[model samples]
Target: MKLHGTVPVMLLPFRADESIDEAPFRKQVDFAIEAGAVAVCAPGFATEFYKLSDPERYWVAKTLVEQTARRVPAFVSTGCGSAHATIEFSQYAESMGADGLMVVAPKWCALGVKELTAFYEAVCRSVKIPVMLQDADFTGAGLPAKLFVELAERCPNFRFAKLEVLLPGSKCAEIIHLSGGKLQVLYGLGGVAMMDGLAHGATGMIPGSALVEVYAKIFRLYGAGQVDQARALFHRLLPYLVFALQHLELAVGIEKRVLYRRGVFPSDRLREPTLHLDNDYQKQMDELVDAVIGLVNEVKAATATRG
Candidate 1:
């Protein structure tokens, strides 16, 4: 049930008119695996959860899991506007053979921590695989440590968490302590604070900035006992990542665009309500991708020289 690692939140592939595209979806899956993703995720947000109908969401989840085929763990987000809907998604995902679920908090109702505990306990009981508590940024709501601990203790599949809060330094440690360090923590904000999170006892990262290899370099180096080297690589990769989404209205759109500009995808498509980057912003993101690609090459060269 331990779920802490660099789980890439998949970017939904859409066509020019913004409908789902299957070709690039398969490619994205292959790319992440080849790059050594610990897991591949299809969160509601990553797959444009907003616009998808319940059936659509299930179909997407089913196909993604089928395609991955146990090559990596699959975490599909199961947060809906209601606890009932969330439970539905969770149970359905488990039935579809997903290894685990990422249950985000309710956005509209904005339940308190006590309510959240009840919610998680119910959903976790409903499923057989692990569940990752995703109580991050949803209309000023956060999952406090007490509730997390309660859920982890009572819920059957409750094991991991994805902390997406914006709170500054050492706040993560506070949550860990509050949870008695029993919960497995993953940094879902990608590369930001990954090093700090690791130092504070986080198990792994779910970095969206890792469409390429620089992100992998850091994770590998850090895992292989090269702490100082990983830190330096993360710092070098950070600016390029920050720049890619700096001026974009929707960061997901920027991420997809970065992949597109690199020719990883022919069309930098986004589902409706997720607009394309403005022309100038697009150009800026292109430059950012160029830098990231360059960073990967530099690291590869450095590694080769050491060898």
Candidate 2:
């Protein structure tokens, strides 16, 4: 089946000290469903997949699927930095009842396209569930759009791709041109490019900002056919989007902190080695949040003025 519709790249919840907060995690899933995500993803790049242990990963997937209760599709990130681990995660995830799998290119190895294809092929063949590709920077993961077209043709289970082609140009155009009305493209980076990405054929977006009411409206407005409204909202959220994208070190913390502050979860805890923001970053992050709120207020005022 083709990847279609709006799906939120769900974030995992954690307690104050950074342990898995299962109760709030499950609640976040329910909130996402309530907010109208047709499908949900677990422990992907946004969910801090790398920090999760095998057992913890399975626990989160099982919890999310259970909470979703077959209400919609549930996808879990199965790609570890290792192919062997990825195969294992895929098997465990499916056995635990995930609706599908989101596999990323091996980051630590910095695999080339060939290695990426081999890794995906191995994981897909090992599982009965459908799998999609998530391409990004250090993973050496961005496959040419043509290669994906071929993969979509060759791999029966290759259902979708989260194209994080950060740069704009021919490759982005190529993905749009070659999607062939087949694989559903998700706009991986969450910002102004979102509207353009959809115009280019990305049916969905894996944005953590979806957890935020205003940001989600930016996406929902577009999906609901209010193009100008959506563009207006996108610009409003652009500052936060840039903050999240620019501060690579603190991106995960930013999402977690924002969600925690919004009461989406119990705490903004990240697992060990993925520490929380420092006082300086936290101070800046606080200002960023203020700026986002200011922007939202400005948009609300502008919208009223337009009315």
Candidate 3:
């Protein structure tokens, strides 16, 4: 399956004790597919993959693949601290029937181009499935576009790039231009830069799952030549996105809360060492979720009618 359109980076639902909440997690998978997600991804930054142990990571991957059940493509994030661990996770995801893998460069220590290239080459070569390089530079300095072109030329499975920089439009255009047509770009950062990224030739976006229906509608409108409609719809979502993306931990908390409000998740519990939304923040989030709930419902009802 081709990795394109709105693929949500899933939020792992947890119980009060921080154990994985299996039932609601399954509901989330079904919800994404029902809401028109082209694919589903998990254990990314938003999923709090850092907090998960190795066994928990594998379990999340396996459960996601199983819940998705090939209804649509499922992509798993397999970026680990070392190349060896990353390859191991990538192969495990592939073995569990994931359609693609999204790999983030190990962020514990910065690696030069040579080291980064070698790391990616090894992982891509180890898996037959398509690998998406996540250039997630939250600090505003992103990987050079030429590195992506170089990796594409070297590794057959290195086919996609996910741009999560401060402003990703130019980088998205540059990577596409440099690679000629070999690489497909997917914008992240909770789809905050989605319209700009789409205008710059991004194939899709990997946004948080709470509002997958709304995002999917925007993508379809853009693809159908309804640029004005798409822009207008995306503008309605801009405020909430800007608010949630202020901090990664804050974003995870907000997404899980929205999912809970929408009745997809039973609880909006984040693991310890996480940011807690104060009373003021909670009120603001509730207002934001209220502002868009109707729009989300309208989109879903329309989709169901069309189907």
Candidate 4:
């Protein structure tokens, strides 16, 4: 119920023709569970939600929820450009049995505090499930900790947040303290600041799914009081994390390639107009993964041994 630990933001698999590859997508969900993710999320930024047609979006969310089947909690990003569409999507996700909903603020145009609150409030009111506000980086909108506290007070179901701020550690700490520990915050931004998020106050993470086991290990290590070990492992993976997150759009291609190489997905295909990682970058990515993969394996071994 707390939704702590790694709830990977899933990547959608596509066939060469650009159709949703259902089989691999399902496999990817199982892969996350096998790797020890606490929950699974879809229709998020990493899922290429904007690129998906309404049917594609619905199918992906419905399939993910059905496949997850309450094995772990599943949350869907139901944010749309308007409150009406957001409510519709949120309700549909709930109908598909999503345990919770994550709504990023409406974008392309800024909303006044009152309008933004109303948008989130409308979505929150439409669902019986818990709602998490996604503080996205796409918009340059700066959400103060007070806004979250105010939303939590207004909507009883507004209990969780996915923070993607510049200074997430200090901001997370501030939100927790200001909210009297009522709001649970999860670190977004592909888990780049995961250790900082955890050390500061993040109860969980919603990172790209290419390496759930790695993040899971970090979370486990931290929780088990192995701060030094956790920090070391995090540093070990820092290179790969840095490269993959360098260009946000390009990061999607990089992650799909990682999953492809890992055999989690059949192919690393993205919709058109995507940033292509040149051969040089691809080689660097290969080397980065090679360097950090052992650390991942070692962390997995450590976790198994600890158990």
lDDT, model 4, position 64? 88
Best by TM-score: 3
Model 2: lowest-lDDT 10 consecutive positions:
209-218
Residue pairs in collision within model 4: none
Put the candidates in lDDT order, highest first: 3, 4, 1, 2
Tell me which of candidates 1 and 2 scores higher on TM-score: 1
lDDT of 4 by residue, 142-210 (tens): 687788898889889998989887777788888899899999999888888898898898999988888
- For model 1, what is the error of residue 217's alpha carbon versus the real structure, in angstroms, after optimal superposition? 1.8
Tens-digit lDDT track for model 2 on 132-158? 888665333367776677776778788
**What is candidate 3's lDDT per residue for 1-307, written digit by digit as tens?**
4566898988999888889999998899999898879989988998999999999999989999999998998899999999999999999999999999999989899799999999999999999999999998987858889899999999988989999887788888999999997899999999998899889999889988889989989989999999999999999998898899889888898888889989999888999898777899889988888877878988878888998
Q: Which residues of candidate 4, in runs, are more than 4 Å off?
A: 138-141, 305-307
Task: Give the C-alpha lDDT of model 3.
Answer: 0.90
- Which segments of candidate 2 are over 4 A away from where they belong? 1-6, 138-141, 168-173, 209-212, 223-225, 274-280, 290-307
Overall lDDT per candidate, in order of appearance: 0.73, 0.71, 0.90, 0.86
Per-candidate alpha-carbon RMSD to the true structure = 2.6, 3.6, 1.3, 1.5
Model 2, position 142, has a per-residue lDDT of: 63
Off by over 4 Å in 3: 304-307
Error of 4 at 182 (Å): 1.4
As for TM-score, the candidate ahead, 3 or 4, is 3
